[model samples]
Target chain A: MPLNISQPKRKNAISLTPLIDVVFILLLFFMLTSSFVPWRIVDTPLSVATDAPAAPEERVNVILTLKQNNGQVWVNDEVLSLSDSSVFQTLVSDNGDAVFIIQAEDGVTLQSLMSLADRLKLNGAETVSIANAFAMPEAK
Target chain B: MKIAAKYAARKANDDDNMVPLINVVFLMLVFFMVAGQIRKADPIPVIPPQSINDTRAATDPNIEIVVGADNILYVDDVLFTVEDVQAYLEQAFSSAVNPDAFWVQIKADGDIPLDSLRPIFNQVRLAGLTKVSLATQLEREAK
Candidate 1:
């Protein structure tokens, strides 16, 4: 007796195009989500007299300036009205180890400045120095 | 004939191996998504105190608090009560390896009241973390 044998037939080839597309899509998703972190900036006012060339070592100091216009207080150029919530508490909470230098315009009112100093001292700031903007002569 | 048939069989089997690549991609996707979920400091709008001295280098990975025009308390952008802040700091200080090395920076509007500022310091003391700093700007020299 004779036996007959048959071989299996192959037809389809695996396609790589779809796999590459999925990999790229995942890469793009991660890149976009990671960049969403927000950045913030705050501005304060500086006294004209205290505005002078600073030595390199003194440049890193954080300065807080105050000015008053028509009984309204401006802190770091941002107007602070009593209606605003506890903004002072927020400031104390965020800055842990920074040095604060307060520079106020002459005749602006010491009551506000002194009050700020007292608060800063209470908030654990080691030094809250006041800069006399009027003590120095006006620069040309 | 045999060699040609073998090559064709090998090519057909390669398609099934693609399952591993798909598994790897999914794993990486899950890892990154979890990492992104961790809470980070929120950008609080603050008028950073300026200084005439340019001696400070910008520090990284520092916690930020924003004092809005309307004196509200915020930590990492979340509105927090004074007591809440105190509780939070207590936990933070307790976990720190060295409370002395851990610092808290405060950026306050120059006009904020002294009365409102006292409780925060009391909280800092309660936390036992002594190092603290205030952010300020340098007084610009006259032109």
Candidate 2:
């Protein structure tokens, strides 16, 4: 018995393999290049000297002196540990409308200062400002 | 004829098997396209400080000031000196369609010393831009 083999002729058939390949590559690129980390913002209204209204006598000034290596936070003359949240809580409650001036000492990072400011804001302290030791001369 | 019919059926079954895979890949493509924010990479990548403030930066400010870990400043991807930052910002402010609506965002490295950033802040203030935002990441809780 002899078998005659004939190839099947298919009309206008397109392979889905290439399309799938391209889609997979695009998915991989998005997965790797995209950042999942959420971004937040801290709104700061830069106070001009002349326009800044004079501080009321009743409003307390809480100076947060930050040092490097997670050093103690000095709120005014009293020293408090960075981890002690209750102290900061009470401080904010006592002076609800206090102006918190975050004074960063030498070697202190912007991270530490912002973290402290965040904590203070969380504790209900209003008006957090950075104390500029090297205050640049006003634009002449 | 029977063998050809069997081969055609097999090919149809193989194509059917890929339907689910194509569906999944298409879904993933759509997910990334919608969920991910495609932002232009900053000239100087800054690891923003973490904060509890979850307020999303609503508007994409016209100006983005990046402060690198080395205290270098880049205003809108252009390298700028401490003195030049104010000038650039002022010019941008003046030329803006809505000066009041025009704002600045400071994306400073988390580890950068605070004193180094003071100058940048001063420049923003001197530019007469009352609205400024400091870009930050969500503070991760202790694991």
Candidate 3:
């Protein structure tokens, strides 16, 4: 028996097998690597400085306290706005060798404290230390 | 006519081939290894405070200590009571090549009180890990 077969016609179709595979792979790669929280680090003043002995030499010390309840920073008896750079400038000018003793109440964010400390450092304060040691936050 | 008959007679062998698939998978695996760090996720949600002068560290932290909301402590995403931290650090420091040079990163929530973080610092100090650092992100203005 003789079989007569017509040659198959070429169809205009692009193969998507590789393309689909690549798209899936790329999707999976991003899903695995992306973190819900992209945590970064900023170190604040030394909290351990509370244990260190007091300085032998009498140097200027500016006290700043953070009351978490009020969400305001206090320098001595006066409330200070963090927005003002001149506050730091005035403090630094008063005593070039001044040290800022920053004390924050429980539940205050470390980020805000660190920024203030950094600002002090930038304004020429030789040392900015956490005045009080860390402890368990008061159960509120 | 002979060539067409020959081609039709043999089954397409390439349909069963998986070489390209395997190659693509291998490349993806390598990309994940190189492009990302595999650090454990912090159990509690923490919004780290921002600072204008914050600087990114040159190296990844050797140890991760997270202070979550409600004053809970986490060491490398593993929950640790305040009491357990000293012992844990003792082990980490003892195993390190340079105990004194060992770097620590503290990731604390913005509102985490200083009192809540004190014990962790003490524990870190007791372990003789002097090179302690607090982790913070860049301020939005800086970003």
Candidate 4:
């Protein structure tokens, strides 16, 4: 019997199929699990009942009332359009250290109140507090 | 012989074609992994109000309260009433490592009425957690 030795052939050490499979899985995971919304925070310091009351003499207080029916805002007694930034800017600047008490009446959307609070804080109001007008009384 | 040669060529070409696809897929994977934030979805969909304030919200807070436009409340994805939230907050506060530093993040729908949202704040107050952040989106335009 004559020895017939076949020439050695090159063999693929690793398959690309598995590697591609993993990459595809990762791509799918990221595509399905990620969120791209740009979220920001507006510091709304809650007036906890536990805090000691500040001195009334030193800090000025400004009342920002949001009316439900008209979608208007009132800085104390004077009503101003929420979009009018100039007047509110002046109000914020005049009372630099004032604590703005935002009172949103019934039916006022949370968005309007948040926008006004954001404006006040942006204009350099030191302390902005929301008055809990709709706070449900103690329900045990 | 010609047919075998053509089949071999086709096989090589098929592998080469996959390289570009793999490269593009890798790029997309990296882009999504880096650019996107992985967060649990909110219990209810909420389109928050927009603001020019550039403060970024904490990625994860100790307490997250979600208020829907329909006056529904969700605490940690569980439906909660005003009274129930107060109890939940108090319990959360006690177990917190630093109770005073634990702030609550409120994600409320822009269309939610203040009447529906205020009681939650009052509940948070009763819990003794003073610090609160209202989640808002960055205003897109000059307005």
Candidate 5:
């Protein structure tokens, strides 16, 4: 009589090494990209209405004020010299859509404000809002 | 004879089947590279002020005005005087649609003077823009 022989079964296993490598690479890429991104810092007063906050569409606030000496003006805290066209050019170069909020002083001349407004209009600031400090006591 | 045939078949296919793995890795690499390319830069660096309750989500393609510790102003990375800011906004408004939909976010430092922010608000209104937002960090009280 001839002896019968049986074949051994082979196990199919999924390889995880490639998947893990891909995941680690993706994680590293995100970490590096996030670090290079610029961050913005702003200082502002608190609002009373916690229930209704400003919409996301309206978030860029351009703080404008005049310096005490020689009536030199500062926008968002940066002093501007009238002779420099670059300053005005830079203001208009913002690619992102941002709301412009003008916070002028009580005694600030309208002429200065108007002149600045004209430039902002050229730069693509679609929505510009004026903030009246006197109207809101909380702002003080 | 059956056992010998089965073993021979198993050994025939085991020589470095890494082509498929390489193909998948390369595909993912290309996918991430394309995705990373589309991200745009933020116009400006704005650290919003802290609020007891800040529930506002971040907006996309929005303008940011950052107020530094020394009360310095930056609009989309460019430094401007109060007058320059107004002029910039005015220029921006002429070409914008509805002029009323534009949103300006102000991120002011905690120690900055309240008086410093006055002119910015004034000019925003003058430009005919009504939508404005203040950025702030949410305060988490210690438990």
Candidate 6:
């Protein structure tokens, strides 16, 4: 019997292993680079006191107390909402030297505090400080 | 005979294919390790407040304070006490690698009322570390 011989046909095929490996690398690159919650810094005024030349007319200090009265915010003793542009203008308009002291009551949201801060800053209340008034007494 | 011979050749090449796959994966893993910021996990759960003025992406910091919604304080693994935390911060600041460029960040929960947050602010101030920043979730990019 004659030995049978046949030509072996090679099938054309594209391997997906490299493509999958590349995709995995890309996925990991994004996972590592991306931050979950974009963190931003809101600069709070420093409590450091600076000595100034006491002028003939000293700047009148304004106290805009933030107290939650019946679940509402009272800004500068006025039941003020952030929407009222008049209240922001009035609080910051009177004098150039007016330094607004924000005395926020415990349980008042920072959301409101920040909004009030923005308004105070926008209306030109040069320096705004969060009061450490309610701070606990120093330990013996 | 030819078909059997061809099958044997292809099997020989497939034997060492895993070596190249491992090499590519190793390179990618190293790339991620170098490029990412690996922050210490917050001790207590903190959901930072949202802000309309949040613009800048927070960069590297010298100190970080996490304020939970329930007003519990956590300085890394240590349970923060009023005096201890202050003293720790004071020490950290004084012995800091770069005091002039030192910065601190407070990661406080949005639900934490301002009143509840008073002591933390006071402690930061009393530590003689002025110009501390309150952390906020970046709302959007500026136009």
For residue B96, what is the lDDT in candidate 2? Answer: 95
lDDT of 2 by residue, B99-133 (tens): 76898988888898777877888888877877888
The count of backbone overlaps in candidate 4 is 0
Q: Point out the higher-scoring one by lDDT: 2 or 3.
A: 2
- Poorest stretch of ten by lDDT in candidate 5 chain A: A35-44
Q: Write the per-residue lDDT of candidate 6 for residues A87-118, one digit (tens) a residue.
A: 67776776567777666666677766666666
Q: Which candidate is the best by TM-score?
A: 4
Once superposed on the true structure, which residue ranges of model 2 sit more than 4 Å away at CA? A1-14, A49-58, A131-140, B1-20, B140-143
Ranking by TM-score: 4, 2, 3, 6, 5, 1
Mind giving the per-residue lDDT tens digits that candidate 6 earns over B36-143?
555656787677876655557345668888878887887655678755777888889999888887777778887778766777777777787776778877556321
* Model 4 alpha-carbon miss at residue A113, Å: 1.5
Q: Residue by residue across B41-120, what tens digits does model 3's lDDT show?
A: 56777777665554667777778888887888888888889888878887887898865467888888877667677778
C-alpha lDDT score of every prediction, in listed order: 0.52, 0.80, 0.69, 0.79, 0.54, 0.68
In angstroms, the error of model 3 at B35 is 9.6
DockQ of each: 0.07, 0.55, 0.30, 0.61, 0.05, 0.33
**Tens digits of per-residue lDDT for model 2, A5-124:** 755665535788999999999999888677766788777777676867866667677777876648478876788876778888898888878788777676788778777777787777
| Model 5 Cα lDDT, one tens digit per residue, B1-143 | 89988776766455235546666666766666655543433344434433333345355324556777666787767787766776777787687665545667766554454466666666665655555665555545411
Clashing pairs in model 6, backbone N/Cα/C closer than 3 A = A106-B115
lDDT of 1 by residue, B12-45 (tens): 6676676677677777777777655334433554
**Candidate 2 chain B: 10-residue stretch with minimal lDDT:** B134-143
* DockQ class, candidate 2: medium
Q: By descending DockQ, how would the candidates be arranged?
A: 4, 2, 6, 3, 1, 5
Better of 1 and 5 by DockQ: 1
lDDT of 4 by residue, A23-138 (tens): 99999999988988788887777654545775565667777788873657877688887677887789888888887888777788877876777777766777877544445545
Per-model i-RMS: 11.7, 2.4, 5.2, 2.3, 11.0, 5.1
Q: Cα RMSD to native, each candidate?
A: 15.1, 4.6, 7.2, 4.3, 16.8, 7.0
TM-score of 3: 0.68
lDDT at residue B55 of model 1 (Cα atoms): 38
Better by lDDT, candidate 6 or 4: 4
Candidate 4: the clashing residue pairs are: none
Weakest 10 consecutive residues, lDDT, candidate 3 chain B?
Answer: B8-17
